[model samples]
Target: MQGHGYAQPVKQPPHIAWLVFLRVLFVVIGIFSIGFLTWAMMLRLAIVTRKSLDWGVFVAVLAANILSLVLLATEPGDEIHTAGGNLGITLLLGTLVAAIAYYLAADIRHFHRLHDAFTAHRSMAPAYGYPAAPSPYTATTVPSVPHTPPPMPHTPLSQPPIPAPPQRPAPARIDQVRAELDELSDYLRKQDGHHDGHHEGGR
Candidate 1:
């Protein structure tokens, strides 16, 4: 029987932790009347990562931080104000802190997702110092022939013998042809003489 198998945990890049810490640090710094810095960092990160940025949220946070700073700086020392400026400063500071914290949490989540993507890409890449993978065209195994074939014997090719020219007719056959021609001429001459004698008698 086979034992249960467990999947290995995925590895993450080290920079992701640093990114999270930096974002959290910015949030902490923003608590000291400078929450606009956190918003600006969020906007920069969003642009770098091609993530969406809520401009409305950024404007509101910046405005609240600036107004809170102004109110605190202008407050008269130890004087009770009827304008409810204390409550107003408290509300603005609360809004700024909450917005900065929310953005920091979002940035952390974005960093994690980015890290996961980087991890997946790195895992798929070829490992260092390993032999290259065989090409797909050469992946199939083929058996090598054990013996070298002997070179084929180089035999000279044979050609047909050319025939000799036909022999000329013999001298004896040439004489016979001349004799037959002479006899034919004599017979023609006798026939012509007999025809002339018969024509003279009739005249």
Candidate 2:
């Protein structure tokens, strides 16, 4: 949307003043008969004043003009005059009149406003006005945020392995084991001999 009191200025074309003049002239001439001149001028007006051509008006006028031409070619007699050629001419006239009337009614004030602006301020009128571009130098404030430090990374501690239970030590000397075995053998032999001698004496 345009600002409340500001409008973007544009360059006024040199041909606009004369085109407006010629459009009015063609319209005046078209009152007597619908012709190519009027159609062409209306198209020019649409191109100049609107963002796109006024297709609705263009189609309506074209249809009416074609109807008038067809009716003219047939040359119907007086008996059918009320409903034939007269109707065709009336359709063309009505279409042109309505088109012009609508243009003046709907757009006259806007046109006057543009003309006044152009003359007073040397600014051209936009066909369909545009929203003004925002000023590049305008100041905008950024919101402030509280500072927060990043979290520290986690690391696992190294642990020592558990020790196994101690085993019993073997004997240090082979001579001690041999002495104990010889003593056991001598005791067994003495016991057997004593038994044998007692048995023989009893016999």
Candidate 3:
């Protein structure tokens, strides 16, 4: 359902002494909400399901959001929040949130459908939030893991050993580069080189 709209955000006077205060209070809070959502979805596998389709949408939306923020931050004051740019941004965010809401709504619908089907077939009955006792002779099977591990002759069937990866050696070039950097740093120190190495460049 379309919901009631709130007051549209307005760009206040740019050079006011209070502008920094407003940024800390308002702009930072909006950014923080984005960060919170990111953390909430960090461990989710829904995006990786179906051969990484979730990743494709996630990456696309991430790129769009980044581009929007860049344009938002670098545009001239008048254009930053103008009707066209604002519409584009609003549509992008609306799609992102609506997708999530749609998934949740669809899942609820699916659960209801499942409950109904179960009732019709009498395959499973519910007792206070738990499924009622399954038929005694009905074979119970657990969900199969998405990944099938390769067999190891040394591994015991009862307890699978989790092997830690062996530590890798640092690249030879990295050590050489570190030594060269240290020599150059020492030479520069002897010459009292300007921290910026801008001896020839004029301010």
Candidate 4:
């Protein structure tokens, strides 16, 4: 769970159908002595594949083919013409053969490089059909041990009881009645004096 997953497969570049057509033209040029067709095909393939070496080969071959053709055309006399034609044909055929060899070698090199890259990528990927091993750098969870509570201390069975607080005695009902009567009598005496003063004033 801690390790990396398998790497996704890499996508190859799209193959151009025109490049295949050029290769077919190369085969055709080998069988037929079509003048400068092989050089033309190589030039097209080089442009399609974007290979500088292929382009260079195409240029060199094209130049040789042109020079030979010019010499064959401008030479005077039958013998000189025959010799020039033969030289031109020989140079053309040799250039085509060299171009074919170069193409094959380039293809082999491309395949080998692709294979090496794929192999390196696969080697770094996680194993198939098995779970990844945990990493040493990752944190591991440890199960905690259940804690046991300590036993409670014992208490005496015959300990003395706690004493209740002392209570105050309440006043008797008769004393409460006597206090109220005294207040009532004082109020009555005041009322009587007030009536007597009012009567004297009226008189």
Best by lDDT: 4
Clashing pairs in 4: none
TM per model? 0.44, 0.42, 0.29, 0.43
How does each model score on lDDT? Answer: 0.67, 0.62, 0.50, 0.69
Give the backbone clash total of model 4. 0
Model 4 gets an lDDT of 0.69
The local distance difference test score of model 1 is: 0.67
Off-target runs (Cα >4 Å) in candidate 1 are 1-14, 34-50, 70-80, 124-203
Compose the digit string of candidate 2's lDDT tens values, residues 117-152: 667554332323544455878735766688899898
Instruction: Put down candidate 4 lDDT per residue, 23-109, tens digits, no spaces.
Output: 666667754755566676667557655788878887887898787678667667556547677787677777777767776566546
Clashes of each: 0, 0, 0, 0
Residues 35-66, candidate 1, lDDT per residue (tens digit)? 44545655545564564455556666667667
Question: Residue 55 of model 2: what lDDT?
Answer: 55
Q: Ten-residue segment with the worst summed lDDT in candidate 3?
A: 36-45
Instruction: Sort the candidates on lDDT, descending order.
Output: 4, 1, 2, 3
Q: Which stretches of candidate 4 lie over 4 Å from their true place?
A: 1-25, 33-35, 75-81, 122-203
**Candidate 1 residue pairs in clash (backbone atoms < 3 Å):** none
> RMSD per prediction, one decimal?
14.2, 16.9, 45.7, 15.4
